[model samples]
Target: MSWTDLTATDLVPLPVVLPLLAAGLALVFARRPRVQRVVSVVALAGVLAVGIALLVLTDDRTLVVDVGNWAAPIGIDLVADRLSALMVTVSSFVLLCVLLYSLAQGVSEEAEEETESIPVSIYHPTYLVLAAGVCNAFLAGDLFNLYVGFEILLAASYVLLTLGGTGERIRAGSIYVVVALLSSIVFLIAIALTYAATGTVNLAQLSERLPDVEPGTRLAIQLLLLLAFGIKAAMFPVSAWLPDSYPTAPAPVTAVFAGLLTKVGVYAILRTQTLLFPTDPRIDQGLMWVALLTMLVGILGAVAQDDIKRLLSFTLVSHIGYMLFGIALATQPGTAAAIFYVVHHITVQTALFLVVGLVELRGGSTSLDRLGGLAKLAPGLAILFFIPAMNLAGIPPLSGFLGKVGLVEDGVRTGGFLAYTLVVGSVVTSLLTLYAIVKAWNKAFWQEAPQEIETDARVPRGMVVPTGALVAFGLALTVFAGPLYSYADRAAAALRDGSYVEAVFPDGHDRGVGESNETIPKAGAPAGPASAVDTGEGTP
Candidate 1:
């Protein structure tokens, strides 16, 4: 269970590095969007391969790749363990689908033949850069490095979010950009405070050193980080921005935003809670309340919406509460449920969005009140939407059921009044989620339109491929839950113990102990009382 050291083969940088470089090349090839698509897909495929390889190589090892050959606690490094590798791998695939969906865009050509040129011709390249940034954030081992990754993608997202520069998109994006900037500033201030307190930015190093620090100071830093990340995760009170801005973007862009972006915020929270503040008592008493409220508020928002994408966006916000519920448990099964749900949500959410996009293309709008009877028109599109919506609502014989059952089981197993409240909230949210999806289906696909929903343009085969792939992945998660569970369990095991933190920096706090990065992946993952594995070893 003790993994001593890890090296490049173990900590391959392809997930981050390949995308980073390819983003620039994609920009270079923007004159030919098809070529840019090819380059981006190639880059993402590389990331996917490396991510899978790294997962196998990082059984128990904390794979670290020190940038510029500098030692930890002084120079920056990248940490690849079970959780990050899983996130990055999934992100790469999502971005790949986004790019593919983008390629078949006819709006550009449709507008090109008109008088004014479409302003957002650069969307493809910028989107790839944003993917690069997401990868960077997941792989980053240091807080500062994470900030850099965050900013990189945030900048690109602002561009992609406001692609058309329409007065409406600009107005919506203006608010989005400002709110996002303010949150980024909040994160920066917290990072500065942490660095001032510890004189270090490496998370692995902070994990090992923060315990000696005063509890009051640690709590302050933790709250600041939470506020910053919470806003981004769209958790309840700070989540209103998501429905407003996300629904305004073009369908493909919205799909990726739904599938990948908010999850980044949740991912940061998971890392912070598990790695930085695992032993905090308030997690049980107060955090549970936030999770419960988040789920309720989000699902409530979903029920009130008639726009399919907007409804899904609100539901996405609520679904995040499920992940946090697992995290609050701070147990192996709890974290494993969080991990499994992350993957399931990614595929299911993306497919639904892509289906919405397809509906938009065929029926010309996603509002249920304005559209109807699409199932009779395009049975194929109906099939795609049905599978994911049913899955999203946690129907049986699907991956969503597995994920929902895991969280519910974890909540019930950690029995108490608070656990009971969360368990009840989970059931209520699941029912509400089903009601919202069924509303969309009955009104948009099953019910008749007001004698207007009609379009002769075919949903192109190219446009269908990416969305179909997403649906297939969702079902595969159901059929292949075994291997997926094994990986999720391993990821949970690695997150459970501090074996990964130790392997990344073998000498621990002291730097001159002649430590060499080793190629051996940790033979076994570490396990302990999740509450007992505190990593706060930094300066007070």
Candidate 2:
């Protein structure tokens, strides 16, 4: 379908618009927490529906919505092709589940009493705004708008991060805010440099113009963008902030941030690597090394953690290396594996955090030293935790295992010392992840309970239900791995084919005045060699 055919595709903007609108309405009803909760849940449910529709619609094509009738390379645009739509759908489902979990947990007595700092009334609205920001970032079609999306989510996150405003949370929030501000400032400077050099910040426009830039200048811009996004994605050397900041937040907040936030940064790297800087051997090699280090360092940290939340946070960083490993290969199977791994990791990681929240709810502490015998006290929670835990460790027949298998296969297929070394590192990381999670399991669920522990702590149905639902979803990804991987492969192909750019600029005007107005190759075309620039035009 053509761009004008978007008349039938108004659903493109609703994922972002609904939550933003609901956030405003929720704020107005903040005093009536019940009303605010209903509004926020309904809005997110609506977004979930829209996400599903967009995913189905864009499965074989692209859908672009130019905001306010503004044209491309100038106006804001929201584009949903296979990749973005899939991300939105998955993330929306995760957000809705976490929101349900939060509401189930209810406001703590301390939060209720600290009305000034906690502002219990604002939680629903701010949470919805956070959802809006995540949706915006995934759907964004240009650099400036993507930055806006980051700021929107980061602002909401700052509020969520310090929800109770206790001393510990405040301190954690302070560190988080400083790091986020630094990243944002760096991101903005990157935007300025990009626009100055290319005369446009629209990604499709950059795809055409960036190649004309001098090699040194292009590499500089590329590294700057990577540095900014790497911090956001919690890559090694920059990931120290995550373990410290995430564990202090309330469970639902931490879960959502853990699952979605870093992935957004990874998504940015995937998009820019393919669209803006498709084939640079040096960049590819650099990413491989970074992936190797992130895997090693992150998993080792997880191994040493006595706290379940912090351990999971470290594991979260470790698995990101798997995705980056695939991207660094810069091949179809590698990209496909990364996309599939992303879907797998988000669900499994978020589900694990939800289970951790449940553990804390029943056992009264996430500290492994204090908890024990949860298997006897809460069999349901034990089962819930066991499934995602094993999945996160890449245990057989689960989605995580499937994702890792794909990555390893791609690495071997790439066939070099670096790829082989990272492959080994990936295996070691997986084994270490298993060891850490099993250690938590033995301490928290299998071992004898301490006398001081509260055996009678209630497991509310609200909390159990969402956590169980997410676990089931993770299993569903495993059960349906064949189709999901196929979808990811197609999405990977589309990214390489530049179908997204064509969808945004259907008139081909953005390809520059003197350039040939050729369309991007179709999805099933033979993929080029790993070293060949997959930029359709083969300019490199």
Clash number for each model: 9, 0
| Candidate 1, lDDT over the whole model | 0.78
Q: In terms of TM-score, which candidate is strongest?
A: 2
Candidate 1 regions off by >4 Å?
A: 1-11, 106-121, 510-540
**Lowest-scoring 10 consecutive residues by lDDT in candidate 2?**
525-534
Would you list the C-alpha lDDT of every candidate in the order shown? 0.78, 0.86
Would you estimate the TM-scores of all the predictions?
0.91, 0.94
Candidate 2: give the clashing pairs: none
Model 1 per-residue lDDT tens digits across residues 87-204: 8878877778767776776533433443254533466567767887898889887888888888887898887777766777778788788878988999999999898787676787
